[model samples]
Target chain A: MANPVWMVLRGVCRGLHLTGYFCAFGTALFGALFGQPPGLRRMGWGGFGVALLAGAAWFWLQTADFASASSPSAVLAALPLVAGYTRFGWLTLARMGVLLLAMLCAQKRCWKLAAVLSGIGVLGQAWLGHGAAMGGGKGWLLFGCSLAHIGAAAAWLGTLPALALGLRLSQNPRALAENYSRLGLVCVGAILATAFLQYLFLIGRVSAFFTTAYGAAALAKLLMFSVLLALAAHNRNRLTPALPASRAALGRAVAWEIGLGMAVLLAAGVLMQFAPPAMAMASMGS
Target chain B: MRRSLFAGAAMVMLAIAPAAFAHAYLTTSKPSAGTTVRLDTSSIRLSFTEAVQPEFCAVTVVDGMGTHAETGKPEAVPGHDDELTVPVHFQMAGKYIVTWHALSVDTHKTHGTYSFIVGN
Candidate 1:
């Protein structure tokens, strides 16, 4: 078993990396879908910087974990081996490259192109996950599900900050709210659908949900997601119709959604550290 | 539209099989865990649940006297991406321990140790 402290540290780094990537992706996507909002450029740049730094930290930590390296020199020696040889290493390097390209696009104010690159970076995450363990058609299907799951999640959660800014800046808050509400609905549907598929593939049994660390973290994430849904619903149903009059309330709700979304992302990061119950059972049985 | 999308996702989910395993884990060994083996056994072989990177994997065999019995580095078995083998030359082993650390092709790490008695 890995040390608890190191595991937590890795999870935190993973969460930060996801948060940063999602922020950049979301900002670009928002601009593409609903026109660029004021203050988004700074947010996008900040997100890119954070993602780059956190991604480097995540790679370093993963190298140490994989090699069981206790010293800096040992980790340094193992870095080349991991970065050059393993699938995870290759994907991480590729993702960093994509992120860099996305940053360049964002700098040039090519929102649509930036969004595409960042979205691909998000999709590439599927390869680093449990979906990559299996081979053949089933593996491909699982990867598809993972791609949808992450993309929907990034689209919805990542866009919240930009949406908040849009709400603040748009003279016609109602139009902006309606457009986002539609996108939010589609993202939510995709999230739920892919989440169900992932549960079947990863969890398999309800009992394992109670028995495993992965399950507990997943449950925590689900709870946070539920809160986010409620907030979205409140915004879409009650707040949007009364937009100008209820902008403050809607803003508070979006802020809450953002906080809860971050929590969910962090839980997801920690959850990936544990073997999914189905996988664990299969290993033990074999 | 949302309903159609959900229905489509449901159909896809029902069509797919659940994933069997993730991360490489030792499933079985040539000598087998906690079993008695003949001293003539020439190598230690480990079979994992998932394909592992052989170049990044390590396997060591040590006798009860704490002397290394393994002759060379672990190597992938021909046509078996999920298996690793290391040649061993046990001079006179009473009890031998085998420890292995594997990096799954997906880059997850796992390790374990097992012991077997080497008899006449």
Candidate 2:
């Protein structure tokens, strides 16, 4: 087992990295779809910077864990071997390059290109996850599921802040809200479909939900997700329709959604630290 | 509508083919765990369910007297990314413990220990 502190730190880093990537991707995507909103450029840039820094930290921490190195020097010494040889290391390096290119595109005011690059960066994360551990066709299935899961999540949760910002500035706030609501619905469908597939692939048995640490964290994430769904329903059914007149209330609701979404992402980060129940059972048998 | 989507997703999950296990786990070992081996055993070999990085992996074989019975670092078997071998020397046969810490290619770390008797 890894040191508890390191494990927690790694989880936190993963959360922050995901938060940053989603922010960049979502902001760029929103701009691509609905025109650039005020302050969105800065937000996207800040997100890219955060993703780069947090991703670097995560790679360093993972290297340390993999090599069982306690000291900075030891970790540095192992860096070449890890970064050069392992899949995780190579993927991390590739993601860094992707983020840098995305940032460059954003700097050039190419919102669509930036969005595509950032979305690819998000998809690239699937390989760094448990999905990459499997081989053959099942591996591809898990990979595909994970890509859809994270991409849809990035689209929905990542877009919240942009929607809030856009709602404030758009002359036709109702139209803007309605557009986002439609996108949210599609995103929700993708999220649900992929999430179920991933759960089946990773958890397998329902009993593991009660027995394993990963399962518990997954349950927590699900609860948060449910709350987010309810909030989205409230926004679409009540707040969005009454928008412009009830913009303040809608804004507060969106803010809550953003907070809960971040919490869900954090839970996901922690969940990745533990072996999924199916993997745990396999480990035990070994 | 949301409820319907959830139900539909559940149906799809159930309908899809079962997935294979992910993450690396010890699948088999030479001088298998908890078994008696003759003194002729030359090395300890371990195979995992997935590819693991040999550069960072560690394996040790120690006798009942707490003395290291394995020599040299664990090495990857040529042409096999999932198996590792460490040469061992047994002087006096008793019970020997084999412990391994493996770092899978995906960067997940796992470790385990097992004992085997080395009797005539």
Candidate 3:
């Protein structure tokens, strides 16, 4: 069958990633305020969860190759649904989810119960993620980087939705600002660290930057990162200290930062789909 | 609670320290993995959706009987990234296997083997 043109366009452009962005923002918004109060945090999280489940279901319903749409909850349900599928789709998701849960739970200070359960989840993903192409020590690198990327993104971007909810609730202005400043710095740091690691993998040679495909992608990502850095500098060096004339303004700047962060993550979703240039394994004298 | 958060941060740092560097994978192959193709096979191609560590990728046609390689290293042609091909000039059609090992853009290495028969 001829592949659907729409799916092809969406696949390359990462239209699903757009939904993933909103869903991630939703998850972060709700998760941040999970125990805090009433309103959207309550309704939005529920609504978002339903939206996610429905999206997952809808994705699965459209799929024809999966033997059957056996379970709506199976992450692989999207395999038959997404255009130009990756062989390791379900495996990749399981790997990312498992490792993410493990990292989340292994905290020496986290709830023992949560840690234990998440630890179990990690094991499950390993069983599923095992593939000749992806696993072992290197897989750990992929898992860790992917988690940091997503976590930092959620913390950074999700804050916007949270801030909006906060404004609606009329929470203490001082409390919100203080919390955001502290948390935002942390998120920025996390994002920076992950980007550094990714850079180490990509920056093979100075000349390659202009000559290589990998280099070009890296350069594009760098340009985007630079813009964010400039915006962040404005927020931290100038706007932040001013007390922003209004708390709402503080929230808006954060929303802008979060929006940029989402764009970065969008590139990330596509980039991750590609392989590392380091492993290009130039077929020398084969 | 704060302590747990800090601890979570620490564990993540340790776990991610290693993986943030992973590369790409070779994913799939043609010639019906394990099946044999003749020496005249126009192209022996390996495809990876991501940019690869060209320095590390190998597309060698190894003679099953002689244990000799059939070609110099294959190269990624300009423009097409999804596939990299090596033209094989088989001295003669014999049983052969294409063994490959590659490092992906994220720097993760993946290796695999596929066989094809070259015969009248």
Candidate 4:
């Protein structure tokens, strides 16, 4: 276990990193699907830069935590040992490398190529996360669910700014809204399904939910997610259909969605830092 | 906007500090992390802060001579889920390095190595 201050610091780094990574992934993906809008291009690059910085910080904190060293020099000295020896270290390094590659591709204005590269990088996060430790086919299944959950989230939250841009620039705002509404629905469905599967695997019995740290945080995240889903539904069914007339409302809705999305990401950051409830209970039983 | 982003990031990081914990830490050991032992030392024992899976836990001991010094597989004590015991087989001993990898019941994996003198 880490000290309270360090734990919070690490969690924040992880939350911001996920936000940045998803935003970059989403922007690139949208660009690949449509033509690159200048605003979207800028946002993607910005996200890539943020993700890179936050990721490096997270790595630094993890090294310090693992080595039980707090000073900058001490942490740096321990870096090679952690990075060379631990599974967590390898995954972090791999993720950082992918982020760099994605950034380079985005800089080249290679939208589609950037999207593919960044997507791989984004999915690689599943390895650093909790579910990646399970053995055999079960591990792969959980990994798949985690990947889908993140992909859906990236598509929904990351592309909101781009979607807003489309509303401003396109002559047929209503058509654009309609197309996005359909895409949003699919993303929502996938997010819900995959999240549910992950919950099932991590929580096991419902009793563990109230008794474990991971479970409590996970429950909070689920509540936040439900609120986010409601906002999405409103945008998809009511606000989006109103189009140019509802543009202001749509923008506000998306902004709120983004805020809630950040909250959910924060919860997830905390959740990943702990052992799942089921594991804790099993340990207790033994 | 930039300031807000920075502030938001800082706030979230601070807020999560008290809630996160994972992996296992070595709480006790027969030879300990870095200590000198007797020439007759014959086994290595490690006690962790969390219950670990025996199947996924392993300890390897190697002497300063770069030869294998541990024989067979390490096993967790039957009633004590947190303790791992491994037999050490070595005649010549100066310093022996012990490397361990543990997968806690929660599926978190951790590995570390330390050196202990066989004879002082």
Candidate 5:
């Protein structure tokens, strides 16, 4: 016989799930363009810190699952979930929404909005960063490690869109050339460091580069990344120097690279939906 | 000429999209919130509209002076119970309160609190 309490609990659980997904990711994505950061108020660090904590708590809860009804670990872990969720996720998000609105009312700068959005971008790493290779207790060190992972990613992946838009904004070679040089140098340090960490985290064994589903996803993204790099090389070497008239052809080439980078990002989105093997091992399949 | 306005309109639409999708909620709790009780209970029970992660979500029994009373652990019932159950030994309780927190699969975190007196 099922208890009425269980029935109600199940319903409420489902509601929390749906609402959390809808508000957190959906709202964050919308905020990206609308001028608010994903989970924090613009123009301050306080909103950003809480947003990070909220993301972590959300991650912790989403990952844990009680196995046996009478397990001690299950019961103990549950306390932190409750405490953190109430004090971290919901409360922070609520504050973020309020502050976000206030910032919208009070501010009038594009860079200000970009800074906020960049803060939201941090969770992308917390959700999907590196450090999966044969870890003992450092399995969940996201605060520093994950931050670096996303920083490099945003610098690399985020630049394509910015650079492409720059190219399109003008037919001037000087502007295109200057922006291209800056973007190129930034991508240099970013791509190398981030790719190294990504390899460390997800592709521990060299064989994993071809073995697991995650490995295959990584391979695909790498292939796409290579394509972006090739096109960038072409733009810098063959196109950035061309006159304003010939810039048309160069613009097309750079746009194609940006397009490829975006495709890689979409695949990344899909890859995140899969549970990491490390995660599975930690849970021990419950 | 009005590029900022266009950006604002786009944001407004995006922000509203997720708000339309609401989640389930807690229907009730027992021995009920804000009720005076004179009996020692075997377990704390919570009723939700959906199944929650028994591991990540839990209820704790706090004493009158804000000390935990559960000797062992709070566990969820097997075979799909709508109400999650927690075992509380209730050691020396003046005013015990049960606070619950949960994060669902969709990644939303929620919490609620209720208090009941051990001796009426």
Candidate 6:
């Protein structure tokens, strides 16, 4: 799709926004359940701040997109109208409120409450993407899947830094790894299952997987995920058992997984920006 | 070098942020966006930059006096995937406002309003 630069801004906004929320939720949720690492705590607070700022920018950018206006003045002029009237605008407002609460929670060191607020922020995100377009029962179902997908992903990718922190602190790093490994496996399973469900809802046809922009982005994400899985398996079976001796290697692998996860997220952001294959095929037919 | 690379990436994202979006746009409209039109007009037609769902699309034409000029549901023009036609009961000479909400087949929602004088 040949879009005006505003959409690109929106995409970037969405990318940053999601990244912030994921990091905030993951760090807080893990910190609350496990030992709160000082580094992860700082990161969670920073991520929450970023999400709030990015979300505001995204709202302005969307206002510009809706008004089909380009200049800063135009965006400002349209901002009130879009924010006041549209469902998206209202959702953005709600998200902002949730984020504010999350920040307060973080400040109070109420990691559990902060995590819950972050989860609310993440769950509400489904309405801004392709799932929002789904109507009737299917839309609701897809939305549920999207929520599950995001929650699982946060639990997995979001907690890696915390895990790294744990590895660094715990004397019995092997025991820590074994415990987290079990939880990580469950998180991965949920991520995969929910992702597949979302794909089925969005793609609607196998051929679309090859022919559409969304399909191509999804394929790229899948490839990245496959590599991530391989790296994870190596860490779980090989490096993890080695414990403190292999701490550096395990840390490096975790860092690599985080990088790949970010790549996957970027692909996801791209996918949301394009029409799914079903829509593309329908457009072609029309 | 790593810090510079991160900064460069941030710069690129910011520079390219406002350049692309996949949402549909109001490409054209009958009587145009802001112009005077004769009272004899029987319908309003809008063209979008993308194909839209006819069932989910809506259009309303109201005069300055708060009287509804729209007479029926908006429809996709046959053979014209991007165009929507709405029947209107336009007769009085006054400013008419056309508000349209469309759901593009790609699931992007776009809406806008345009006003035109119905009398010379």
- Quick one: best lDDT, which candidate? 1
TM-score per prediction, in order, is 0.86, 0.87, 0.52, 0.73, 0.47, 0.72
Model 3 reaches an interface RMSD of 10.9
Task: Tell me what TM-score chain A of model 5 achieves.
Answer: 0.56
Per-residue lDDT for A1-286 in model 5, tens only? Answer: 0233432343333223222322233223223433333223222333333334544443343334321123546646554554454323344354345435433433443444444544453343343222221122343442245556555444544444334444555446556566546746665566565565445444445576576655666677788878877777777766777756656687677668656755665455444333333222211101
Across all candidates, the chain A TM-score values are 0.95, 0.95, 0.60, 0.91, 0.56, 0.90
Q: List where candidate 1 sits over 4 angstroms from the true fold.
A: A136-138, A280-286, B1-19, B28-45, B63-67, B76-81, B89-97, B105-107, B114-120
lDDT of 2 by residue, A74-177 (tens): 99998998888888888878887887788688777898998899899888888776666665677778878888899999999888888889988889989999
> What are the DockQ scores of the candidates, in order?
0.38, 0.42, 0.06, 0.06, 0.03, 0.05
Which residue runs does candidate 4 get wrong by more than 4 Å? Answer: A280-286, B1-120
What would the per-residue lDDT of candidate 1 be over residues A1-286, giving only the tens digit for each residue? Answer: 2787788778878888898889989998998899887788888888788888988888899889888888999989999988888877888888878977887897788989999998999888887776666665666777788889999999999999999999988899899999999999999999998898888878876777678888888888898899889889989999999979998888888989989998998898888887777774333212
TM-score, structure 1 vs. true: 0.86
How accurately is candidate 3 docked according to DockQ?
A: 0.06
lDDT of 1 at A26: 95
lDDT winner between candidates 4 and 5: 4
Clashing pairs in 4: A8-B13, A8-B17, A12-B13
Candidate 5, true inter-chain contacts retained = 0.02
Give the candidate order by descending DockQ. Answer: 2, 1, 3, 4, 6, 5
Off by over 4 Å in 5: A1-107, A110-113, A120-143, A277-286, B1-120
Give the per-residue lDDT digits (tens) of candidate 6, residues A1-286.
2373545556667777777777778877777777675677677777777777887787777666566677889878867766665667778788878876876787688888988887788778776654444443555566677778877887888777778777777778788888888878998999887876666556655577788767887898899999999999999999998987998888889889888887777677667776654442222101
Model 5 error, position A14 (Å): 19
How good is the docking of model 2, by CAPRI class?
Answer: acceptable
The DockQ for candidate 2, computed on C-alphas, is: 0.42
Model 4 chain A lDDT-worst window of ten: A277-286
Give the Cα error of residue B59 in candidate 3, in Å: 15
Write the number of the candidate with greater DockQ, choosing between 1 and 4. 1
Shares of reference contacts reproduced by the candidates, in order, are 0.44, 0.45, 0.02, 0.02, 0.02, 0.01
